[model samples]
Target: GPYVIPSETPRGEKYLSRIKLSWSTMATTASCPPPSVLLPIRTTTAGARLTSSHGSRAGHAVTTTGGAAHARPPLPMGMARALLPQRAPLLRRLLMAGALAASCTCFLLVLQAQASVPPRYDGFAYGVGAAAWKDAVLVEAFLDPLCPDSRDAWHPLRLAVERYSPMVSLIVHPFPLPYHTYSYHACRALHIANKLNSSSTYPLLELFFKNQGKFSNRATSSISSTAVTGEISKMAAQAVGNSVSEFQSGFSDMRSDMAARVSFKYGCTRGVAGAPFFFVNGFLQPGGGSPIDFSTWTSILEPLVAHHGQTIEMLTSV
Candidate 1:
């Protein structure tokens, strides 16, 4: 398996298309350097500037800036070539014609690995999004209702879903940590609330995040449980525009329990370790699970979206 190096660059689509057209399947037997790497790429008319080793140790990644275009550029070669499976001579010829920046080469390697096999568990993900489409990028977010970081990640992720609605699908799976004592209960409650009124999902989630302290604080724990129940009842009434008691009765229903179990199982089966795990197009986000701002997401997604369009155009032309 080739370690995926995530790249953010405008020209990725052409490179990806070229790799798909020219290269044979990359072997899974190839030695991988690390589990993941993040590369930040900036391109100018002159050439590309790549910041490598985004999430790994200092020496693991390599960056190239400014001088490649002037100097005889290195051949667009993936890192650790000895690790790659044997390829046809034609593959080498295509790579030599237009050299990719170091990071770009690594991204192509990741793409190659993806093309070689089926996804690990495509059906387990859940959330709001279009039906799965080959061309649409699948973004799976693992989040905890009680985690501050998850709350922070919500805003930027929402922006991404809105902006790239046509090109991407966002699926969120709740992963409540045990340490957050009432998190499971909250997850159950919210799931039922959302099921009762599908439109209430995001708003109720926002409400939970905004008032997290009330639910988690030691002083408020017992008192807040009852209080929060009432609060959710009020919210459910408002969301469903029905009698509060009727909505409240459904808040902790059996269906919500089943939904919570499903989400927890999905995360656990995938070996999700903590609060905020993100996967873009089935490739786990390379950088550690930190909350990325809107601009950062835009940088990562725009290239994928553009690459998708270019692929469609290329197919139409043929």
Candidate 2:
């Protein structure tokens, strides 16, 4: 069977000639329909529209007047598939490879972003010359002022810091636990005390730890936050030898709240999940989130102190 041209006009003749020439060139190297099957191709001022003629509604293929071709449509499912070139396999493979590469790049970027050390805040350090010793071992304790576990751990921690003296530095970070309703207020009071007198920081913290039961959820359930804050301010003022009015003024100050918020956020960056969590030399100490005995503290500090001394001696010799 011979192919039939659809029209007798000059434009139709031109289209027929182009189709015959394209069919002849493509038949040798590309898969296409037999000579009797007609492929519907229309040319407009905008572009050329190509459609599969053999009852296949798979998709359309568009080409610009300048001969630049866009993405080709998928072929028909069964016998009509041969009417177009078989390019799906290669295109699918390329798309899959691109997606896999993108996924791997994203995964690596996430890992790189997550790989970092927590930052240090020197202002929270306690005791004389705490932040002065550059080579000393750093002991960062993230504690909740009203947490029972934090109260239990404070004694041993204080003793350990005192025993190490200038060889170890201890920084107390206030991480108020949500379940403890008044922990934020207590921590805010401690920050205020710290600003009034750095020496009063530890004393005020010790007092809060001792009287935590008074500010517990059960005890303060019936009282307003203002009453609790006033009581805390009075205790802090007494402990720090400051007037109650001065302490109350600082308690209501926004700077104290900002300081407490900064400390809590710093703890979060270090992945502090509970009160009394500890980090030695920027590394989290296992089993430190609980109440560890003085002996346990000694066991951990002895080696670190010895190492510190050795490093100092070596640097001095150098």
List candidate 2 stretches off by more than 4 Å.
1-123
Please give, for residues 1-318, the per-residue lDDT of candidate 2 as tens digits.
Answer: 324444446776688678777876776566554332345454555334444555634344445456865544554454366655567598889999999999999999877755233344534786774757565888888999899999999899889988998898888888999999999998898889888987898888889888988899999999998898889988898888899889989866998887887777777778889988998888998875698789998999999999889988999999
Worst 10 residues of 1 by lDDT: 115-124
- Local accuracy of candidate 1 as per-residue lDDT tens digits, 200-289: 666667777887886775745667566766765775566556678876676547766667767777776677888788888877775545
TM-score of 2: 0.63
lDDT of 1 at 245: 82
Question: Candidate 2 — number of clashing residue pairs?
Answer: 0
Worst 10 residues of 2 by lDDT: 33-42
**In order, what lDDT does every prediction score?**
0.65, 0.78
Off by over 4 Å in 1: 1-135, 224-227, 287-289, 316-318
lDDT of predicted model 1: 0.65
